[model samples]
Target: MLITDRHGRILIQRVDYRTTCLLPGGAVDADESPAQCAARELQEELGVTTTVDRGLAVDWVSADCLNAPASMRFPGEILHVYDGGTWDDEQIAAIRLPDREITSVEFVEPARLPGLMAPGDARRALSALRARINAAGPALLENGLPIAPTVLDRALRTARARHHLPFHVGPVPEQLSVVQVWGWLLAPDGRVLVLLEPDTGAALLPGGTPEPPDRGDPFITLRREVCEEAAAEFGEPLFLGHLCEPDNPYARLRYAAPLTRLGPPPVDPATGRTHIRILATPEQALELFDWGLPATDQLTAVHQARARLGIPRAARQPLTELPDATDLTTM
Candidate 1:
């Protein structure tokens, strides 16, 4: 099985007998299923009990390719890789290794595994990571790669009608004069950061109409608004799509980013109060946004972002149940 932290760092273990590290897995017992063996091995090796979900990939280690002595090498082996879901820092810290077999456990970046792990093991881990990302959603390439437009991209391009100046959505008649820019800022754990309007008690993404200083770029406007509202910095931004109101000409140019840094929440100049919430799932976002069309579009963008970033989907929750806002002070 392949295990990784929330940020996609592979959890590698150094065996006492082997010079290079490998993933945390072991042979399946005579009567146990692969999943059962994976869970058991994780518990025995790391003293951590976690569910082994869907299989990620499989590796066939040929007898000729074995690095062990001829006597120790078997005819062949088929290894099953499973997805060990993301773990928090505390869970990672609690991992206790069996020193007799495992010398240590460390989280290593995927790119660095090639140098630290056996060639075959490194290939297996990298393959599993790619499979996990592909299964999660559309593959997101590194910056500057030639990426073809995805289905979401095509839809957005076709739906774009007219671009207006940025404006806020409110009860006033003049509020619809321009489009709005909304940012879907996600944390490493896959939770989204949302802003709460103190005056209206509405939960909103950290953005607003572009101010004059924004220089007319939606991305720049969103970056500035996110910093101003949540005291957060945007990572590489991915243009998800446009959320056009059916009844009105107003639309929201939505952008998604894995937040780079988060500081103390500043009072939004527009709202004059500070209260930001982190939603654990898209369903919670929908409920917090009152199940409106904009919320639905935001949910879509969130899904797209998760797929692009290779983040697993958050656990499913009741569609109508609203979770309490996690105040910025607690974040």
Candidate 2:
């Protein structure tokens, strides 16, 4: 089974009736472990021309397998899955699986995995795997990722190694600013509470400062920023402080967003990524604040945000800091 991220479709090959259309893997040779076997089979079938990325997990499929045996085909299989730690999708796709025994291969979105997988335990395996990945990340397995029973701090250990990119404790940027945005939330009395133009010359909140991912929390930055901004602008909160990042900035996305960004645009300095998304809502801003919302000519990023407010502060900080959400509630 060659792994790919074709939008979301995972391509699979049904090699034979015994195995069905499954992730690329096969029976281990004498003295070979399942991991060695899967890697070998994927390369053998998909062809080693493509690199296997980091290992995702081992799925246990002997119990619910629908294939007829050799009696039940495989009574159970410990599937060692690797995402193929793909770097470039284009490069991966270019690799051809010329082995002729492969009957058919095609892309199927992960969401469509349940329907494509043969029924019985495989369906359960597919469903459970999807749920676990959605919740705990794709690295955990059906039997659990840490089943090895290794000796370590039970609280600290995870199945993940240094291979994956999305989360790296030392991998995260050390210092980052928490930007507190305050926009007009219409009051029942019709008093539009907004930062004074004379104060900020813009409707954005006054607080923007760097904080550690580990220590002098970003929440502290947010609260301290709000107070300073409020004092400078004589802006009083109609409902108090609100904070937002590009996509929760600190968390995973909650919903699917449809974006048609065709661009040769600016890079986000904070993320150091080319895909720049600079947006906020009074509802989103107000989901943490309150009100209908305020229109643009209102938001700014990092250092420039502070500079525009006339609040003297530097946006730079060491990456060791972690955001303290309590700072806003503490006041």
Candidate 3:
């Protein structure tokens, strides 16, 4: 129990047979620490406030139950008292006790404390409280231990390492291509194009031929297929190249379009250049059936590219990344 008043006056509660009043305190509970117990009781007893700075006093009372006041030595049980503060008389008078164990109370001034309380272990509490007051500003820790610098480096490092890894989307294996092709992009609006497969017959786009490793040419086969199928003498297929193989389906549908078909001629008569079929408006060409190849996605990709590469259709087998006009290179 602790006793303190607002204006530096000490509270003494009369309990047991002590001639004078003693500071109010109680036994620590079974599972509570001494500091915590002290604070709890101090608040419960004195209606006044209490705070524990380091532990103020520690004493042992043995065979307290003996009536003969036998001089038994203290073995284990220890009592911890705190040098809480003092209050003014008015504040002291306001302090009340839990009626069960306390009989009366009193306020004692430091100069006249000796005569008011029994001169036993209780007197020691007064001396301790005074020493605490003399120490000045900084208060003590609840358990008398000093707080020091602590490092959390390893913990921080562990957290960062675990949290920084990229989220795995899924598995994708790289694929090598074995063919290269080209198509005749027709339509004044660029909405229709042409392709072809050897056995399946003439596709609107003319392209298809097994490619040799690094054949050093994409139009290599485009010329052959165009002449064989359309006999249309193209000056080397201005090389708009390959579609996906339908195998390498891109994660987000590789919509990278390298499509560049010939544009309409200028109205200037002397602007001498051969007429070409780059922009084929839907109104001019018949709506041929969409590419009906086994690779539906690849056909879809080619379809999308013909229609302004609407969305990046995923890479599909039979459809491969196309080569630029300069990339005479083959798969």
Best by TM-score: 1
lDDT over C-alpha atoms for residue 16 of model 3: 59
Stretches of candidate 2 exceeding 4 Å from the true structure: 14-20, 49-53, 62-75, 87-89, 120-331
Question: Per-residue lDDT tens digits of candidate 3, residues 1-331?
Answer: 4454432345677775555666777778889988787778777776555667665555443445222434443343455667665455566566667766677776544334556655444344544443343232222222221122111100111111111112112232345343435454332223333322222221234444534542635445554444443333333222222334344542211111333332232221222322222112221111122222222344444454545533222221111111112111121
User: Mind giving the per-residue lDDT tens digits that candidate 1 earns over 1-331?
Assistant: 6776644467999898879998898988899999999999999999999888688666667777776788877776667778887677899899998859998888766667878987777766766665554344322232211133221111111111222323222232434444688877776656666655544434567778877887767878888888777777767888766655557866667777876676665777776787534444555454333232344444666787778986667664211111232233332
- Per-residue lDDT tens digits for candidate 2, residues 41-157, read 767776664444445555665554434457555556565555543225565566567547666667554444445565532443343333222222333344333333211111111
Candidate models: Cα lDDT each: 0.63, 0.36, 0.39
Cα distance off (Å), candidate 1, residue 284: 19
Clashes of each: 0, 25, 38
- Lowest lDDT sum, 10 consecutive residues, model 3, at 152-161
Arranged by lDDT with the best first, the candidates are 1, 3, 2
TM-scores of all candidate predictions against the true structure: 0.45, 0.38, 0.33
- Candidates 2 and 3 compared by TM-score, better number: 2
Candidate 3 Cα outliers beyond 4 Å, as residue runs: 1-8, 16-19, 48-53, 60-77, 88-94, 136-331
